[model samples]
Target: MRQQNHKNTFLKTIPFTSIFVEALKQSSMWVSSNYIDGNSQFQGKLLLKVDSQWESVQLNLHPEKLYRKGVGSDDYTSYCQLQACFLKKFTHFDPTMPNYRYGIRLQFGQQLSHLLCENSDVFKKWFQFLRRFCIMDKFARKYKVLGKIKQCDPVFGQCLFSCVRVQDAEYHVVKVIDKNVITAGQKQNLYRELSNLRKLSQTQICYIVEVFEDEQSVYILYEYYLGIDLRTYIKESQIYQMAEQSSQGLDEKLVADILYGVLQAIQHMHSKGVFHRDIKMENLFIPEKKRLPFVVLGNFCYSETTDSTQYKKCGTPGFVAPEIFRSKNYTSKVDLFSLGIIFYLLVYGKLPFEGKDQEEILRSNEKCDIDFKFEKKICKKISISGMDLLKGLLNKEPIKRLSAAQALNHHWFIKMGTRNQRNQYLQVQRGKSLSTIIENSVDITQSYYQSNSQLYQSTKEDDKLDRVEKEFIKGSLYDKLLYFNSIQYQPSKIRRIQQST
Candidate 1:
């Protein structure tokens, strides 16, 4: 009977001889699971087929042995060893069984880095999880595994997680998407642009969401934050929540703090020659703790500038600047105008130029009438000075609107608290003295303008226009050239001038 059992075991192991040999030759087959505090219990396979599933084979994985992978040592043996662990799990299983699989579920206590670190197989598994959850389509939408949320408006988005372990490595999987559709190339381009921007900005305005393509659309994987946004902070009165009920809503000082951080972020982008065409309350994210909230500006589909513009006519209607609708030549000031609107919203829950119709709103923009009634009633409790600062930002004309930096210097902010001086903050890194910080910020702004000036100049060289020639032949080829060269690519002046004449 024992001999028959041995013969059966040998026959079964014959098909998986390579994996058995690999286990013998390699030593790092098992590793300690430190990422999650729980003991590394070998959870069996997730069934891929209707019934075939993984059977757990108890193997001890060592910590030092696992560290020997992409922190790179010539651990070809480790690779084989890891494979062997999977093979061993399937050793006793019947291949013909409807449920025969091999995969180990690595559970962790908490903390994201545990899943992201060191072990190559583990990292790859984690990345796979991200792809499956955050970037996969069939699972997120088709299955509706991640339900929808109203907060992700104009476009709704969703996310989920899956975990895996190979040796000492921990792996995590996350998925994300917009309710509307998107293409692969569009996803790639947008993700690349966002990745580049995240590295470029010194401030936390940009929050990077890891996105990849799956099927017809792209999926975005990100860390989940159960934090509040600046809008919520203002609305919920966080200060009041912390056993301080007397302090409700946003105060002048708090508003300044928020604006300072926002401006720094916008300034950082402008310096890069990339304009955030859409800047609004919903786009920004803030954590509940002491850490500052960063603006997560989105909807680059309609972004435009002197050198780059897409006439997609995108943006929230009320928040969009006047110039976008007017067909007038415009620049980064459009964003400033949007920022002004946000500033108004931050101070007063209602918009400054509300109207029953589009025509009425346009008229309001022309009149620049910012009523003080709300500010008088609500903001008086915060600071009259804060109200004035908001008024300065809520200027109707883009020209008259406060430049992001100038807004930082308003009397209300200056008196609120000791903030990093604008110039220092731009030039030096974070954690410097207030005055130095301000100077650093100014220098950074100056450097940005300088860099952008050079970039714009280069872009112009390829698509340069002879302004004089254009005006001279304003009715002919010259007009055509200017219109063609424009980012919007519309023959705007010719038709309008012709009609008027």
Candidate 2:
């Protein structure tokens, strides 16, 4: 099969997580079989189709998400975590009877459990999805799921995984969204965006490589790039610490470097008449391969052409342009306004505006009265030219705000950054810094959120906001342009699991 693993086996040493066992969002697709580990095998029904039901046991497996075969059974209170499963697909099969064609022998320590699936197609899916929880030596074998890149987003029913294409051994970030949860409109929007992204892939610096959909889900694959999102980068960097001390804004040079690449990316989109309504730090990816911070803009869920009119009130609250709130007729300048928010963060070491919750933040954003309570102190951190660029981009009036192209030509870029820094950013190359803050840091977002702990947990008033954002804002089909103030788009990269000491 073209969609098959190299050895048809996972390395025996790779450790697995219990994510699959814990996430019971979908059916278990398991049946207790008498043919399992010794006399402990209990009888149960596999949810095979009622029209052609067969008395057999079957299961879906993957290393990262180890399936507990006997979970949710009244008789079998204990969980059966699959340690190593020996899968044998019989060449011969029969639909008339339970003459098994697929054989799966699962081993859990000293405990052994065996399952037989009647359908060959279902059996293949079981083997494929249950492939690996870790990387492969040969660059994670293409089309093979190496491991989960991130947990499922509660509101959107989407998650990310790291997969590899076998032929070229290129790693990809697979965005899996459950088709059952989203609305038809959202699905169409997704398909249309994916199509647009494909056409732009050849020209754009970074974009989704391909998209695939089946009966249950949509998978959008992105080329694997090392580094973290700007949101996480800010929170984990010395910036957060400095902010706590009410320290000065970062170096104007670094701030300019961080924004240079992202601006060019937005400029390219705007030139093509596309407006990325969502330009928050979470949507901006900074590659860590070089000291110079290179940025990649992603997540076109809210992006639309200049002519297309929708999601007028759609965007992350604090970063959204004021024109978006004033009128639905906002132009591509909205993106430049959002970019201004990122600039404010890089300079001030915190968001430009803040409130107890989303409503307050949106109100603050609408006024476009940048909270310069500490403007005097902040003025010391950034140059007059730098502050001028920030104010220009963030201008509430779309007609007045600087365009992406203009922002590139702004004196701040020319004055604060070298000619090489300004031009070299368009292409992913060297430079130290924003080039933004790069770190081998802990899952800072994870630390912030322990119990459904949302990002930037220092603020408790945001609990209601987090719940609303995570639960889909009451009957909304599409995931809102979330205004949680602290919800970071957590993306994990493939790292070797260190051998336990």
Candidate 3:
């Protein structure tokens, strides 16, 4: 309620209404610019930037280059010199005269242009349009073309594309689902994911912005987060450090921040009856540069609604909770167990359950026999408080495992207030230093997800029949959503790779 109140208060301060914004988008008037040899009324309109992820609306005198590109490819041109495009710092509005009520000057580095909208209403429309364009569109289809975030896109299913809303210039990522490649069952999974994301979006931790679909595709848009996942960050940053014997793993404070973020995400999920069956380092993000301790927890593929039922087997080998393998009735405690694996790895610099192959790893994980090997390096990376929290989360007994809310209040977390500990953080960064790592493209083919081919090859005929029956039910539920007027969907069931009738 407090958060909602705060949001309402913040929004109330905004000047324009939706009607005013719409008027600005459609309204254009004669505009004069103070450019060298520029006409007092140059051929210009309230122009939306032709090619931009950050949809920018400028009073243009002519079609202008965003800035000079240094003989780089078109991709480079799109992103480079974007700072020059936003003239908000140099913009000011005041009435010089009745005829020239709105005066706007835009300065970019050395370049300068002054534009005027003589009429007051038209000028306000332009002003409001300019102010609001920086806000990303509420819809996914509204995002125009931007460079691909990954070096190579996912081959099939949901392909992730990097995008920006031109108006607000806010970075957004789009997950594109090709309807053709997906079976009706696969389509149902998509809808389930969509439903989960929508409910979870209210948490504010979820950056889901919008969803759009047509006959051929479904696009789920999300606010883009810069940092890589905890797994990638540690592998890239610490593997070499470990070789040099300088650091054992992520420092104590760093781990705290990452875990705090994950805890917050999990807490919200649990409150909403969602249990993330797969919570691991790969799913936990590290906000290395961000002072806030809370890192983003994402990837909802294996998460499901936790009702009173024994869950089927799912999730990655090392991270899946032991009770899940038992196939007994369980609750959201499974997520806490998965989170413990992440906690241990961050401190120990290695997975607790290690094996030569995934099968061996699964066996080790099923036993729930964690070998806590203490070393000087581990001591340096974690403290008694940290260790206690890890132990509480990792307890094999579901009843004994710490709930997300309980975990958040643990002394390990309570010693530091959830908010206002930003200064202790290393530096303020949004994954820019690690941006070069984008070139190190992942092999999409050998991805973490269980491929359709692998599943088919491994399953027996009876297993396939069971899968078909389950999918048919899910597909019918998803089809029901299509008949609805909106995307207010409830996931009829959870993702269960193996289940009993």
lDDT of 3 at 331: 81
**How well does each candidate superpose onto the true structure, as a TM-score?**
0.46, 0.53, 0.53
Per-residue alpha-carbon lDDT of candidate 3 for residues 1-501, written as tens digits (9 for 90 to 100): 654664343223222222112222322222222232221112234322223221223322211222212222222122111111222211222244335434443333233334456466766654443322122223444577576554222224327787877777777777776756766555545544544554564332545665544445556676676467656765676653664365434456657766777787888888767787777766655443553354576777666776558656788889988888887676888888988888887666678888999999999989978755445344254544456577778878787677887776554443343343222221232232222211121111122112212211222222323343323222333342342213211112111211221
- Candidate 1, residues 122-188, lDDT tens digits: the string is 4344333333212211233322223433244233233334322233233323344442464454444
Better of 2 and 3 by lDDT: 2
Q: Write the per-residue lDDT of candidate 2 for residues 272-347, one digit (tens) a residue.
A: 6677788887777666564436667777776777756555577898888887776777788888888888877776
lDDT of candidate 3 at residue 162, scale 0 to 100: 78
**The 10-residue segment with the lowest total lDDT in model 2:** 489-498
Backbone collisions counted per model: 46, 14, 13
How accurate locally is residue 196 in candidate 3, as Cα lDDT from 0 to 100?
A: 57
List candidate 2 segments past 4 Å from native: 1-142, 151-155, 201-205, 240-249, 288-292, 309-311, 376-379, 419-501
